[model samples]
Target: MSALDPSVAGQLAEDLPPDVFRTIIATFEEDLTRLVQELQTAHESGDQNGYERAAHSLAGASAAVGAVGLEREARIAMDHRQPEAAATVLPRLVAEAKGALEALHALIH
Candidate 1:
């Protein structure tokens, strides 16, 4: 498994201007934060469909930015279609995503 960080610069720097790459990273961060919120809300409300949506979104977004840990956790959560299973995975997914976000912030700054 790859280590997680905001590695967008390495992936996109060759093709994009530094400013634009930074913008992409910033956008990713914003979107991820929002998705995490959605996951939290869905988990709290026992909304299986909402949880799955948020988890799937998180998995895709994190994968795009090379957030391996977050992506892995999110994928696991996403695979849990049942409410009980999703609820069981939510804490770990949230924890891993938060850790990945911290790593991303450190890299961005």
Candidate 2:
């Protein structure tokens, strides 16, 4: 087993493993990418609902990983009356959150 194994950290194999860790990272990355793209599309098309939904999802995912700072930023972005400001903020949120998720995988794997 790897030194970073969750199994060695008093965690059970059934609850954690390298494969599961990778999947979690990949899933988060893919979703974040999609969310950012959707936010851009919404901004381009002036779709307020899409902006809100994507920003909401980004905030939730960021919060899940204890990324309260990013979550707050995302919330502020969502609060902006103009989609341009939200667009400017959404990419940073996605990038930083992706970094956090990758770091999480490294810690567990």
Candidate 3:
């Protein structure tokens, strides 16, 4: 998977007032952190519904921010549905999420 697409985010930011863009990025980051934790918790507990919800949320968030890598992984987890199958891919998904967040952080800064 690729990193966050700054072009998409940059264009999005350009379309908004600077303060509003910052607020959006800030909110995205906060939600992303929470969602990541939710995904982990759901996975650990084998909560299939929670897992799917977290994955779906993450996918939507990443897509909004043009975080391609995380979005792809999230979609994968969301599609698998089976907790065990989804859990098997969590490591890679986690890594991609981290990288995507880092890229997004750099973009905003």
Top candidate (TM-score): 3
Q: C-alpha displacement of 96 in model 1, angstroms?
A: 2.9
lDDT of 1 by residue, 64-106 (tens): 8778888878887787644546556767777776776666555
Quantify all predictions' global Cα lDDT against the true fold. 0.73, 0.63, 0.80
Worst 10 residues of 1 by lDDT: 1-10
lDDT of 1 at 64: 80
Model with the higher lDDT, candidate 1 or 2: 1
> RMSD of each candidate?
3.1, 6.4, 2.4
Candidate 2: misplaced stretches above 4 Å? 1-15, 80-84
Model 1 residue runs over 4 Å out of place are 5-9, 81-88, 105-109
* Candidate 3 structure quality by residue, lDDT tens digits, 1-109: 4577767777777687877877887888788889889988998898978988998998999899888888888888887644557557788788887787677666553
> What clash pairs does model 3 have?
none
Using lDDT as the measure, the top candidate is 3
* Clash tally, candidates in order: 0, 0, 0
